[model samples]
Target: MPLTSVEKDLDALTMTITADFPVPVRRLWDAYVDPRQIERFWGPPEWPATFTRHDVFEGGESHYYMTGPDGERAGGLWLFDAVDEGRSFTVRDGFAREDGTLNTDLPLTVMTFGFEETDGGSRLVTVATFPSLEALEQLVEMGMEEGTKAAMGQIDAVLDDLRSFAAELPVAAQLIGDTQVRVSRVIRGSVDQVWRAHHEPELMKQWLKGPDGWIMTVAEQAPEVGGRFRQEWTREDGSDGFGFEGELLESEPPHREVTTESMIGMPGDPARNELTLTPVEGGTLLTLVITYPSAEMRETVLATGMTDGMETSYARLEDVLV
Candidate 1:
């Protein structure tokens, strides 16, 4: 209930997972960082792991892919946080599209993974905090505990693979795209829930992805042409990065809403983030059209985080909607 061994839930509503492994915290911590060591044990029964890449660090990322024991493949980001050497680190856990592309429709999750040292071995505790109650229940029903166990098992296997696989690969330089990211996702929640999920500041924080210090400044709803729907994204760490700022191009409240321009770090005047909604699946299909005014602007924004960061965000969104 508390999600850890320390507390219990009187409400009996929340879902939290705690597990121990036959290893030391130091060894476990090492396994988490060395992406090469992660691919071995990340999938469930009959689901084998497939590695396209693994990069883990502060501000760095890794991706662990699973080819189902049935030969199905899924990829997501391995972003870390709260990393204490020899102790444990947390991963944001981002999701990727089928062909290993970022699903812009999803926001990253703020999942906390820890490796604590014990006398016998190490105790690993993974707490995936959901943004809402619906999110928490959905994850539990979706077999989050069993799934995590499988993924952790994969982590163990990854450590084994590190022995045979090449350990060192040069990191790739930041690359932005000439192709704009046009993305859409269908969320499975009532219109009110989806509207509340996006329009509420507290709800936004649970899924918004970025480096530390990433915060949303606004989430107001005004249904008018000249009306403004402004949101400023900030970083906890003092990096002058661009965030979102937009004006309500059009709005129909719970039915549909659109923004003309939304930019990162700077005002939406130069850059734009457009959000459109259509009723679908008894919920809504959220589509985003983000336009970076200049090539440099696009590249600069994309340069800040790893691809997994986006994946983890999407997974969180999936967690909430389901």
Candidate 2:
């Protein structure tokens, strides 16, 4: 499932949901930022939502109602506290009357949405903060957790429509070894530019990301065969993030390079990464081969998704190259 985990912290009075999408961060962000798009996937399939009013700026108010299969209606309001375009946003959510008036008698919560670009795709972290542990537990008992998951599960369909409308091409991948898969892209830059984008820490920071809001806060690298590199990325608030480190197994400038990458505080062993750059007619052909320690690992990675991240990263690389 796209929804990976749902964690509720009693002491902190917060419930957070982690979900990954095999779509560009910009496209996923639009699912929330665009009112027309928001209504499409804002509720479970059985209880679709309709927005009567939506304004996403700071202090703006959005009013919507979800209609159940049985014709029951649940109205809600989102009082925007802050909005960071394409990266994150904070809102005060609560029940509302059909006329868009806040229902003070009902439960209210503060919600924050954070988006990050990961190696596989875009990771969306959503946190709902309640007034107290009691309030949180009460919502959980009301099936808020399950409802939210069901609602988010529909995001893939929304993204699929957007993808079709944009007519974007998917990245191509091929099985090159028993435990390896090769993903390739034609980058619109010279071999030197493509090589720098992959080898130089500064250049790498510009395009090696899944979504739009995140920045490579720390990028340190050494190009020698025995040298090591580290890259850390985080949101502006630093509430959720991760870093990875690796050692260069082979370093041939502008042509080939290899490394073993291991994530901090993550399961599974390190994976081997090999990159090849070939000069092409109008640009450079960049190919990346990832070798897993086991066939199961490789299959798992493919099953989870990787094309969106690769396509987004390449698109960003083209922007940087231009």
Candidate 3:
């Protein structure tokens, strides 16, 4: 999270600010396009902005107001003249009245925001052109430069908050005939975080155990396509233990994974496991489906209270994520 560099050029009657954000271009673009997200970081550090109307397309209009420390309201407007999704946009920014109308007596600046993908993440460049040097000086005197920089500084935290919302506990188990058992839950984090928790051995060891007394000592994973993994579970006394080995048939980071799981103690056949992560409103919906060779095999596992074990394990997983 580098500080934005603000450059004021009175000779050109323009001001430009450039900053690098350690997030994807889409995330950076959303700061300018999405009203809900924009409101979180659209003003100075202390003076927060609230949007009343926001339409982020070409020829659209946005109306918002920033609240001062003493409860003073400063209304502003953005009239979009051009828009290129995830790329660039140009808008006219000016003072507005509280009733959602522009105040012609105030100065206006035409601002263009450009987003570009960088080696690390994304770079955002904003250029504001004023009608004259007097207007530019007026804006600078009004603390626009410092206010805009402070607003941009909040982007990193806002993006993190957007990804780390509350989780929803899904139905522990749904038995679909004899062929499948679905275990699903919504984790309160990004798709990448959830995926890494499942794919990486260190994160997996945090929550992949069954009962209270059992400990997962070994978690070896090769998380690429055609890779293999093994998980070993042991009791506190080291008297009772079992393990499962699996091969990844399909692997898609932050999305889906298909694998074949074979338990060491199981007498019958191996199970095909499919884990899918879908991006929902607040977090990721992780759906784990276990398919058996036959209905009898599924019934046998269900009768062993596998659903209860999964429910307990997933409940413990909440702690790991938070």
Compose the digit string of candidate 3's lDDT tens values, residues 94-177.
Answer: 999867699988888999999999998999889999998889988899898888878888888876665432245444665643
Query: If the candidates were sorted by their lDDT against the true structure, best first, what order would they fall in?
Result: 2, 3, 1
Error (Å) of candidate 2 at residue 14 is 0.6
How do the predictions measure up, each by TM-score? 0.43, 0.51, 0.52
User: Which candidate should be chosen as best, given lDDT against the real structure?
Assistant: 2
For residues 121-147, could you state the per-residue lDDT of candidate 2 as single tens digits? 799999999998778888889889989
- For each predicted model, how many residue pairs clash, with residues at least 3 apart or on different chains? 32, 0, 0
What is the alpha-carbon lDDT of model 1 when measured against the actual structure? 0.53
Among all windows of 10 consecutive residues in model 1, the one with the lowest summed lDDT is 167-176
Q: Give Cα distance to truth, residue 311, candidate 2, Å.
A: 32
Which ranges in model 3 have alpha carbons more than 4 Å from their true place?
164-322
- Residue pairs with backbone overlap in model 2: none
